[model samples]
Target: MSEHTRIDCDIHNEVPDLEALYPYLPDHWLAYCRESAFNGPDAADYPESVPTTARDGSSPKPDLAEVQARVLDDVEIGILNCAYRVQSVRNEDLAASLATAVNQWQVEHWLEKETRLRASIVVPSHSPPLAAREIDRWGDHPGFVQVILPVRAEAPYGNRRYDPIYEAAIRHDLALGINYGGAPGHPPTPTGWPSYFIEDYAGMAQIFQSQVISLVCEGAFERFPSLRVALIEGGFTWLPSLMWRIDKEWKGLRHNTPYVRRRPSEYMRTHLRFTIQPLDAPPNPLHLAQILEQCGAEDLLLYASDYPHSHDSQDFLLDLLTADQREKIDSANARTFYRL
Candidate 1:
C-alpha cells in the first residue's frame, strides 16, 4: 500500500478559542480559562489549570499548522477531528446551540482548512430532543461521520431519554462515539473521592464499559440495525473482557431479552469498531498477529494518534501489523466504517 493510504483514525483538535464559533456567548464565557500546571495535590509543583495569556493576553490558540505537520501530514492520516465544547456546555439548550455552532465553525475553519481532516456532530446529551433536532440538521454533512459524546454522566446511556439521539444517528447513517471528559456533576465513582483529574481520566474505560453493556442489553443495537458505534479515546484491550462478560450473561438471561437475536460477540463484530491508540507494546509481530487473529481483522480495530495530546506518531503501531493487516487497519477498516 502507498504511504498516503495509512489512516490515523483518532486525532484531537484542540479548542482554545470559542469566540469565532460561539459568537452568542459573552466575553466572560469565552474568558474562563485554565492551564495544566503539574501542581496542586497531584501537582508536581505545577498548576493543573493555568490560564495561558496570548502575547497580547488573549485566549489560548490552537497551533493548527504544527498539528497538520506533526500529525496529519506525517502520518499521511485521514483524521477524525472530534469536537470539544459539547461536553463543557451543561445546559441542554446552550449545549445544543454550542454543538451546532462548533460544527459549523469546524466546517468553515478547521476541516475545510485541511483535506485530510473530518469531524462529528457534537450533540447535547443533556437534552436528547434538541440533540435529535441538531443531528437531523447536520447529520448528512459529508465530513461528519459520528456523533461525539463524552461519557461523564451518571445516567445509563441506555436510558429512554437518549432514544431520540440514537434514532437520529441511525437516520443519518452516523456512528455514535462515547468519549470522556472532566465535566462537573458527573458521578465520581463507586468509591468516591473526587481526588484528581488523572484519576477521573482513568475511569473513562469503565464508563465506556457501562454504556456498551447498557446499550447492548437494552437492545439499542437491535433497534437501530443500521447505526454504527465507536468507542474512542478508550483503549481496545478492555473490549475482549467486556465482550466475554456480556456473552456469559446472555446465555443465562437470553430469555429476558429476547429482542437480542445474536450473541453479544456477534453484535460487536458487526456494529462496532474501535480506535487504537495508547496501545500496549506487542511482544512481537506474532503477538500483534494473534490479536488480529482473535478479533475480526478487517474493520475491527482502527489507527488513531490522539494527536497533540500524545506524540501522535504511528511508527510503533505500523511496525506491528503485517502487510495485509496494515492495509486493513490503515485504510479499508476506516473507509468501511465511515463509508468513506
Candidate 2:
C-alpha cells in the first residue's frame, strides 16, 4: 500500500463546561444558565483537581497550535482527530444544546484555525434525534471526520434509538466515534456507582466490550455496513479475548442473533478501529510484538497520544512492529477507518 502520512487518531481538546458554553446556548437556556446554580464537575476532559486525571508527566501546551507542534510539526503527523467531550450534564435538552455548541466551538476555535486538525461531531447520546441533527448539521464539514458519543450511555449504543445516528453516519460517511465520558442516567458500573476513581478508570475496557457486543448482537453492523466505530481512549489488549469469546458464543447462539449472519469477530474486525492510548502492554517488552500478533491488532490499533491526559512516551507500541505494520497502523488503517 502507498503510505504518505501518519495520523493521531485521538486527541482531547476540553470545552471546560457549562460556563464556557453559556455564550453558545439559546437565549432561553442562557437565561436559565445565568439564574440556575450550575455547580458541575469538569466532565469535558477530566477535572483538573482529580490528581489521577490531572495531566502530569507531559508539559501541556496552552492552545491547539502548540499541541500540534509536538505531535505534528515535530513528530510529523499528517492529521489529528480532535474529540471535545461535554455530555455530562443531566438535563437532555441542556446536554443537546451543549453538544451543538461544542461542535461549533471546536470548528470555529480549533478546526478552522488548524490546518492539520479534524474533529469528531460531539452529540447528545441522551437524545438521539438531537444528536442526529448535530451530525447532520456538521458531519459534512471537512474539518469533522466522525460523530462522537459517550460510551457510557443509558442503554447500549446498538439500541434502535441509535439507528437514526447510524443512518446519519452512513448518509454522511461519518464514523461513530465512541469516547468514554459522562452518561448521566447510567452509572459506569453494572451495580450502582463505584466509590473510587481507580475503579472507574480501570473499568473502561469492560464498558466498551458491552458496547461492542451490543452493536454486533443488535445487528448494527448488518444494518449499516458502511458505518465504522472508533473505540477512542479504550485499551486494545482486551480484543483477542473478547473476540474469541464472542465468536464462540455466537456459534451456539446463532439462532438468537441470526441477523449477525457471521462470526461476531468478523464484523468487529471489519468495522471497528481503536486508539492506542491506554493500551495494556505486556511488561516483557519483547512480548509487545507477540501480543500484537496474537490479537491481530496490526490493522485495528490506531496511533494516538490521547494527548495531555495519557503518557506512554516510551511504550508507543509502534517500535515493536515491523516497518510495514507500523506504516499501516500509523496512517493507512485510520484512512480506511475514517475515510480521511
Candidate 3:
C-alpha cells in the first residue's frame, strides 16, 4: 500500500475484549455488570456468550486484522482509530475507575498493536472530581488524544457542574468530544416514544446543536479560553443555522447571558472544530462550501469515515472530496485541527 497524506480524525474502532480490562473497574460496578448486560438482554441471559465488542454487523468479535487491512492497506488511511471510550462508559457511578480501565485497555491493546491509532479517555460526566482526576491521570499518555463524553447528560454542558472537566481539558490541552447518546432526558416529544432507531437517530443533530448553543451562549468558551471542542458524527451541518439563530436571539437575550462577551458565531469559529462523516446523502458541494465559508472554519473541518457504518468509509469519502478541495478535506484539515 502506498503512504497517504490523509489523517482520518474519526473512526469507530470497537473493543472485542473489554471484559479482560474489567479487573480495573470497581467491584460494585463489576457486580452490576454481572446482573445486567450493557449491550442487551440476550447477552444478559448468557454472559459467556456475550462478545466484548461488536463491529458493524459482522461477527460478535470482529477480526481486527480485517479492519486494519481494509482501512490501512487498501484505503491508505494513515491514522484510523477511535476518539472516544469504546466500552465501560455507560455506568452511572461517575467513577474514574471505568475511565482508567478503558484508557489502559486502549494502550495495552490497540495502540500497542498499531502505530497509526489513537484513542480518547472516557470520564464519568456526573462526577467532576473523578473526571478531573482521570484527565490528570491519562491525558499525558501518547496513545490518548481527547476527553470524550456523551451529549445526553442531563445538565447542559455549559452548566457549572462541568466546569472541572472543562478546566482539566484546558490544563491538559486535550480536546473535548461530544458524541450522541440517547434522549434529552427531559420531556416527551409530541409523538410520545420513538418507534424506531431511525426516529431517535434522526434527532441527534438537533440535540448536538442545542448543546453547542447552550455551551456557547452560556459562556463556556469564554470561561475556558484554551479549551477545544469537536462535535462527532456528521451532525456539524447543523452548526451554521444554529449559530445564526443564536446570534439573532442574543440581541433580545443578551442580558440572560451577561458573561458571554462575544456572539455565538465568534466563539464557535475560535474554539470549535467538527468532523465530517456519514455525510448527508445527495451531496451538495456548493451548500457544504457555503457552510464552511459562513462559519470561517474551513481549516478546522476534519475528515472522518465513521468506518464500518456503511455510509462512511474510505472509498465513500474519497469520492466525496471535490477535485479542488480534496487535499484540505482529506488531510490538511485534520492535521491542523488535531496538531498531528
Give the best candidate by lDDT.
Answer: 2
Report the poorest 10 consecutive residues by lDDT, candidate 2: 74-83
* Alpha-carbon RMSD, each predicted model: 6.0, 2.8, 4.8
Deviation (Å) of 144 in candidate 1: 1.5
Q: All candidates' TM-scores?
A: 0.82, 0.91, 0.81
Candidate ordering by TM-score (highest first) = 2, 1, 3
lDDT of 3: 0.63
Q: Estimate the overall C-alpha local distance difference test score of candidate 2.
A: 0.75
Candidate 3 ranges with C-alpha deviation above 4 Å: 1-4, 26-63, 74-95, 182-192, 281-284, 312-324
Residues 1-340, candidate 2: write the lDDT tens digits.
2244678777677664557666677998788777887643335335455553435644432367657655565333433344444456667787777777777778787878887788888787667887888889987788888887777777898888888888988889888888866545557888888887778878877999999999999999888888799998878878888888999999889899779898999998898988888777777767777667766888898877676665455255866777888878878788888777
lDDT of each: 0.66, 0.75, 0.63
Q: After superposition, how far is residue 23 of candidate 1 from its true place, in Å?
A: 3.0
| TM-score attained by model 3 | 0.81
Residue 233 of model 1, lDDT score: 70
Tens digits of per-residue lDDT, candidate 1, 72-99, equal 6655545655545454455555566666
Off by over 4 Å in 2: 1-5, 39-45, 51-62, 75-86, 314-316
Summarize candidate 3's per-residue lDDT along 1-340 as a digit string, tens digits: 2235566666555455547657766777677666766531111111223331233553433335655765554333333344333223444452456567766766776678877777777776667778888888987777777788766566779888889998887787778877655333442233466665565556657667777888888788888888788777645666777888999988889999899888878888887877776455336656766665666545556766555444433353345445546677667766655666
Error of 3 at 27 (Å): 5.5
TM-score of 1: 0.82
* Candidate 1 deviant stretches above 4 angstroms: 1-4, 24-61, 74-77, 83-85, 182-184, 281-289, 311-317
